[model samples]
Target chain A: MTFTETLQTKKFIVTAELFPPKGTNLKPLLEKAELLRGRIDGFNVTDNQRAVMRLGSLAICSILQKQGLEPIMQMTCRDRNRIALESDLLSAAALGIENILILSGDHPSQGDHKEAKVVYDLDPVQLLKTARTLETGVDLAGKKLDGSPKFCLGAVVNPMAEQLDLQLAMVEKKIEAGAQFFQTQPVFEKKLLELFLCKTKDLPVKFLIGVFLLKNSQIAMFMKEKLGINIPDEYIKRLATAASPLDEGIKIAAELISAMKPQVQGVHIMALGLEEHIPEILNKVK
Target chain B: MIITKQKELDKILEKLKNRKNIFIVGCAACATKCATGGEDQVQALSVEMSKHGLAILGSMVLDTPCDIRVVKKDLARDDKAQKAESLVLLTCGAGVQAISSVLEDKELVPALDTMFLGTIERLGNFHQFCSLCGDCIIDETGGICPVTRCAKSLVNGPCGGALKGKCEVNSENDCAWITIYDKLKKNKTGIKKYHNIKNNAAVNKPQKVKTR
Candidate 1:
């Protein structure tokens, strides 16, 4: 089924963000995509995430489409100016890649090459607006195109953010920018989802709760430091004290899915390089 | 104002490895306030160079090193400056560039790294002011700079990673967008004050001005 059909018809949808290989080789990534063939509604091909240079997301998305799997192309505002972004969007659409997730990517300062000049020519809001505009027959400048691309536009959200009201306001704005769906940051508590869901209750956008699978207490603490995500102390304590962190992580993820599955449309598992462990997670989620 | 700090004494000495004569130029303005370039700093630097047996042609703390007219006149009249082979500029990047503009023949080495244009909260306290992106979005962001302050430079607001009102990259700082959001709300305002998104494209870099 198409991703939209899965969203509409199924009781719940499952998706994953695919981390492509760092090198030029696509065989490893293509093999991984083949491994996740039926496991998700669609896999989001990440752009040069964490500001690290990688195989381009559009290239992988196009190849993934040819391989008969639905791909959600993750595009960030860090690397491209307006023309490159608009051109890439159109090209991705032409190659039959449908889903597009827009983000204001991590700055180069945090990445390997601190000297790399950032080109945030379009803010995330502007990016969303541009994508929406392109979907209609004109570019961001309103120039006529031979054929505009149709895309299922998506944006990211942080439900667990301290500024709840501001997040709510932007939820309204993203919807205004023509975001059909939102894939949120990893959430650990119910109150956050409850508050965000209640606040955005009136909006038409679909919310996919992000489930970040922790490797261990070390990884958990590291993620908190790097991403500024506040992982619940209990989860950390559980990972910290567990006999096997991997096993405990799977158990916790399954429990989290069980707890949160009823509250939202679906979940997006961010295994964070633990793609091999996903089947175990899915197995226990039942 | 642009902020900078003194380069290490060892690093400075290493740069003067082969130089027999050197003239030090310090700024009395920003560099003095930052303690990077000042009268005492120049004197102390000269003393340190003396221990290494390097002959100091002379040193002066000019009130405004970046002012072309003042600096050009000051350098022209200074006898000690003319004798020196290397000019060690203990000032901001602008000061070094200003001196270089006139003293093109003199080999000049900057003794400090230029940090950022900032606002002085108080003595020894500084906050980044502007990135000079050319397209100003401060009015929309409640007088805070999303370009300079936001870790991701996200104008829209905080990214998904901001935790507890702090930035993702630097937690000590309140997220610029959050600050903007609160400030706008307190002012009974919103993003309507900001220009359209296309305006950001104006920063297509190699950004310059021909004030001439």
Candidate 2:
């Protein structure tokens, strides 16, 4: 089934991102894919997540497709330009990869290789426009191609921006750029997400609120201090004070999903390396 | 093409004493292809000179330094002419003369040595090919010119001085004639047209300097 169709069927559509292993062995990741196959509507295959090179996202999505799972292939503008981006999209369409999540990837400095040069030929907004242009068989420069590609182009938004007006402006721009759906950054403070959702309710796009599972108090604090992700003090205290951190984190995540179910269209759970406990979290919400 | 190594810039700058106005010019056509006379390379050079306490007047890039029309237009827009006592041409010798021909009162210097036309395999990697001998022989050799392939520019067969498919003198590279022969033979073609022929040895002449 198409990703949109499946989302229409499920009231609170739950999705997750699975990064392929860096090593040649795919047995572990394949097993994880199988575990979440029926539980989640679809899974997202990240394109070089955190800038650490893994197997290509297209290949992983193809593998997931063979496993009777719908895969959302995440495409980033970090490594490729308009030409290469369009070529990969056409290949994805030919391979029956329907769902796509576009992102302006992290800088090369954040990755293992700090010396690698970055090619930001087109930003995330431009990439969304390029995807729409590909539907008409033309490139960004208006050059016609042999065939066009069909894609459910999705974009990312950081709703936790310091300025609410700036964030709302970007949302309007993404909607104008042909972004059919948006998967936002982790929303720890439900109030902040509520404000963002209210401001963007008039946008003609679907919203999937992001939920990141915290392994422990230390990791949650690290994300707060290092990544500037505003995980509330109350949530951190709840997880830190629990006897079983995983169970506490899952309980809190399930609570969040249940609360946000009425506010948004879907939930994008980024368990990070905690794929095994996703079923536990899903079981609570379902 | 304009061939330039980073080390060559140091050698030329060593001769200059005081930092006056210095204008760096780059060629857009052949020099850009070789990457030496490109705008990015010229900007890098300009920044380096600025860091070394040299007064960089300005920098510019022309489409083709050898073209008379381009030379005239570049000279007309030379606002940096008053800052520098001389101009540094980051192009082939031919291009240097072309720039000098248009600006007779200014001193022109060669920032790069004119090398034979070639293609870049990767970054910081270069390989020479065409000598531009004023003739074309790509029709007979299955589109691979033996003149550029052969170490000795032999139009016939192997030079008998090849070892392990490599030129005996230059162990770093393969014998071009052997590669050409193998390519032609694999395509089931004959080399009878490339029989013994005698012609004057091509002389390595530097591009002529013209003064208007």
Candidate 3:
């Protein structure tokens, strides 16, 4: 079933992030997608994830759809202006891509091209609203489209963000702007996720808790220190002291998913380059 | 106020390598306040340049190099400025262009990089507060401009990256949207509607205005 159809059903929705290759060699990327072909509901093809330059996500999504797989096209406001952003959405719809995940995106300074110019002409919320506007057969400026595109719009949230009140307000704003579902930043702590869920329980939307597979303690440390992700020391300690770090990482992911599965609608696993180990992690989920 | 930063001495010399004699010009206004183009800076740069073996014809700090009339009346007829092969301007881009407009024959080199339109928190501490986008929405945002202050220039609200009221992009800077949220909440104001997408036409390149 499509991701939108899955979200409407009572089944637990599952999605995983899939990044395009840096160069024209798509063997590795396609191979990774084929491994998890039927395991997940949708493959979130990232648009230059973290501002790093790569092949366009829309093309990959089209390729995935042609291969009989559901692709969630991740759109960011970091690289494209309003005109290009709107045009890309139309192109996605024409190509039969249904799911869209809107993001404000990481600033260009954070990526490979530090000196690149940022074109956040439309903020994430504004982009979500613009996508909804496109469904009405007109563009942001009320320009007519020969045919409108339909989409199941998704957005991102930071459940572990320190400023809870501000984050909740923005979540509400995203909902009002036409975000039907949200995928949060990686959450290692149960309390943080519970608090976020409790606070936003009234909001009419689905929450897919972000579960990043921690390969080792060093990566965990980097994420905690550099990326500002709230990874508890316990998980880091487990990864550090474990006999096999990768297995321990999978266990941690499985444990988090199992514990939080009842509360959240789904889990969005971010394998970060360890896509092959995703099935192992999911197998441990019970 | 306009914030300015001095270009590297090597770069300045590189641009002036072809010119014979060089003249240094500074601004006494924002450049002075920013310590990039003040009289003291101009004098220091002049001494520093001479050490690199470039012939210095003369140096002067104008009251405002951005004012075309001021540059024309003050520096245009100066003997040293007229004789110099190139003028190394310590003022902002406005100053370089202003002097270039009147001294059409001489090569004008900008010594300082115009950083941003900002406010001075204290000496040597500056914060950019405006993008000069030509569209103002501070009234709806509790006087805080998300357009200029937010790292992403998000107008609808804060991006999810803000942590502990600090921007994820720059940890030192407080997230602009959080600050705006606090102010509006303190005033007991309901969360305002989305400001919508910014009108980029208002921020068209090489913007100009006729006050009259």
- Rank the candidate models, highest TM-score first: 3, 1, 2
**Model 1: runs farther than 4 Å from truth?**
A4-11, A141-143, A221-244, B187-195, B198-212
Candidate that would win on TM-score:
3
> In model 2, what lDDT does residue B135 have?
56
Best by lDDT: 3
Model 2 spans > 4 angstroms off: A7-10, B1-212
Give all candidates' CA lDDT scores: 0.83, 0.74, 0.90
Better TM-score candidate (1, 2): 1
DockQ of 2: 0.02
For candidate 3, lDDT tens digit of each residue in B1-212?
Answer: 89999999899888887567899999999999999889899999999888888889999999999999999899998999999999999998888999988999998889889899978999789988888888898988888888888989999788867766788999998999888888888663345477767778987888788999
lDDT of 1 by residue, A151-208 (tens): 7888888898777777777776777877888898898777777888888877787888
Provide the DockQ value for model 1: 0.46
For model 1 chain A, where is the 10-residue window of minimal lDDT? A2-11
For each candidate, the DockQ is: 0.46, 0.02, 0.73
Report the candidate with higher lDDT, 1 versus 3. Answer: 3
Model 1 accuracy (lDDT, Cα): 0.83
Instruction: Give the clashing residue pairs of candidate 2, or none.
Output: B21-B83, B21-B84
Where is the poorest 10-residue window by lDDT in model 2 chain A?
A: A161-170
Candidate 1 per-residue lDDT over residues B174-203, each given as its tens digit: 878877887888664474332357465467
Per-model C-alpha RMSD:
2.7, 21.5, 1.5
